[model samples]
Target: MALPLSVLLVSLLLLIAVPDIYATFHHGVHHAVGSRAHHRIVLPKHHRPKFKPGPWKQAHATFYEGGPGSFGGACGYDDVVREGYGLDSTAAVSNVLFNNGQACGACYEIKCINSPQFCKRGQQSLFVTATNQCPPNYYQSSDNGGWCNEPREHFDLAEPAFLKIAEYRGGIVPVQYRRVPCKKQGGIRFTITGNPYFNQVAVWNVGGAGDVVSLQVKGNKKLKWTPMKRSWGQKWETNAMLVGESLTFRVRASDGRYSTSWHIAPKNWQFGQTFEGKNFK
Candidate 1:
């Protein structure tokens, strides 16, 4: 049978267009579209590590009364503001989000939802660092004073951070939140402490993944790196006498990224002094 002229032309058009359509769809699926941006995040050149942003999930938020001297908690940070985290941009996440202190320094974006009366619509979401932990109250039920109880995700935001998303009078408001990479200003800061026989270091001002998973230290006289154990939270310690020797540090974050800071601490470094070193992207 002889095909009509119009039918042959239609068949030819389909062959040409179908492949292009399939390619476009395939690219979209592989690239993965990012979430709608409430506000543009400007990352620094050294802080531009690509991270897979998690999906927004439901949670609850409340505020606690705290100030500069009182902001630090389980993360080993003595003063969050002095440590580079803004007073209004810090929060204490519950156990689920705190990840047993591993969540320290991790950033998150949160916004109030389902509470039009208190939620300020069209405003940028609240971006905060997990500086502390909202401990679970075994003495109270999850619905009562135990809002941070197990299985319940909650955020005890700093008063200022809370007000950015909801009115203080709201006490607690429904919110949607997701993990975000921290954008830090400078290199990682290491606060050294302890006696000559023991060395305890607190890691802070971290960027990128924002949480340290493992740390190793080497002295100027030593060829092999000495692994440091996590003393508590972001604090890692080693018994090796690093005194009188210039110190180098290797830090690894949760994202599997590594940064080496060579001779960050001087040979004459003293306890209670802090030094800056290379940061991760």
Candidate 2:
């Protein structure tokens, strides 16, 4: 009962004409397995876009008293105006934007939107430096006293900054904000603290991408660079015995830019004294 030769040849031709089930088609063209269509493009996690560029994001803003002695907040930026931030142009951001104090010295342009009644008539926007953290009050709901809670972006702006964009009575106004380059006057400033064996430095008055990511300290011209760990907020500390030596610092900003300040501190520099160094563009 074997098939005839002609029938067997026709069946073999039909099998060869059949298409593959897994084949990818484009423009009615069938591509077989192992073609370029089967390949995928993958990007590294660090290379992925973290935020959209040039887009204003939604957030809430309220005013806070920006007194002389009470200007500093969680980021330890004491006396913001004295640290080169202009008068009343400072804010305490919510946890998300604060990014565990990495957002310290980061400048932002904020404006009241969708509320014409409260928004200023001709003022464009207001620039403010992130000087503190608006901690979330978990006792209240997100819309109430917990405005700074997780998943919510809030800005506790200085009273003057808020007034520039909205009326004082607005209280909490809906706003749009975007990160902007910090326009600092002079160079980066470092305030040295801590004991002789441990040095805690508070960095401020930074320009460009103001938030510092990595920092290294060289005790003097003869010593190698030693990396400093972030103690808290913008304060970086090192346990090296760098007492009585002129100090130089290499600072790396969040934008991956680096700046080196050579021998900015004198050997006789006091613990309470602040030293100015080179800054980023």
Candidate 3:
């Protein structure tokens, strides 16, 4: 009654192979389902936040045309250069929002809500970057108590951007604004100016919550990083003589996140030289 050896061997192989086959099939199914679920959970590109959202505020906005004197304001950016940030028809806010240049480079979404003449069709919203400060002296001198003197959250928009939301005759319109992340193209750029002994750097083309609040610099010769003062607008300056061929910078945004750019300045770096570095976005 003994079975054939060949039959016994074949039976054993089937027992082993069946389980292996089932396991392989089950694993494939699980992997496919997991991948599809992950894709579904991802957010859309446009809806993504440029930076973490802050509190919303109601305010008023006025527009002005860019002319000869419209170039530089309290933020210290030279509109004539056109290479620096905020030279375009952007928006300037009062000291309450400017925070003495701390708000420089901050981005906001402003929507025209009131003023029937401007919002007759529907509310129009525009995303603007803060590049300048609305001076308080101008407000004090105006008869109507200019927007600069307003309680807080007042915006002086560039004429072109403002017209997108309101008519030219509207002059001033009620608006609601909220802080949003800045979406920038490519990496951040560092422009070095002044002599090596006293270098001033302007950081621009920042993405992902683009405004810089604090900046620090260090060279190969220095054992520690030196904090740079906000010279004006987006420029940070250090009086220390950077003798090394390369330099590094650590930048902190308004959201309290830090991004470092290492060895951005090359050897033989001269005044008015610009180097592009990694971005936050």
Candidate 1 lDDT over 119-196, as tens digits, reads 866858999988999999999999888999999999998998888888878899999999888888889999999999
Off by over 4 Å in 2: 1-54
Worst lDDT window (10 residues) for model 1?
34-43
Q: Which portions of model 3 miss their true places by more than 4 Å?
A: 1-50, 67-72, 79-89, 137-143
Number of colliding residue pairs in each model: 0, 0, 2
Report the number of the highest-lDDT candidate. 1
**lDDT of the structure predicted as candidate 3:** 0.75
Instruction: Specify the poorest-scoring 10-residue window by lDDT in model 2.
Output: 44-53
How do the predictions measure up, each by TM-score? 0.80, 0.78, 0.75
RMSD of each: 14.0, 12.1, 7.0
Choose 1 or 3, whichever is better by lDDT. 1
Which is the better candidate, 2 or 3, if ranked by TM-score?
2
Compared with the true structure, what per-residue lDDT tens digits does model 3 show for residues 92-186? Answer: 88878888787777778888885777753664568887877877656353336566764556888887778788888888888888988777766
Relative to the unseen true structure, what is the C-alpha lDDT of residue 133 in candidate 2, on a scale of 0 to 100?
89
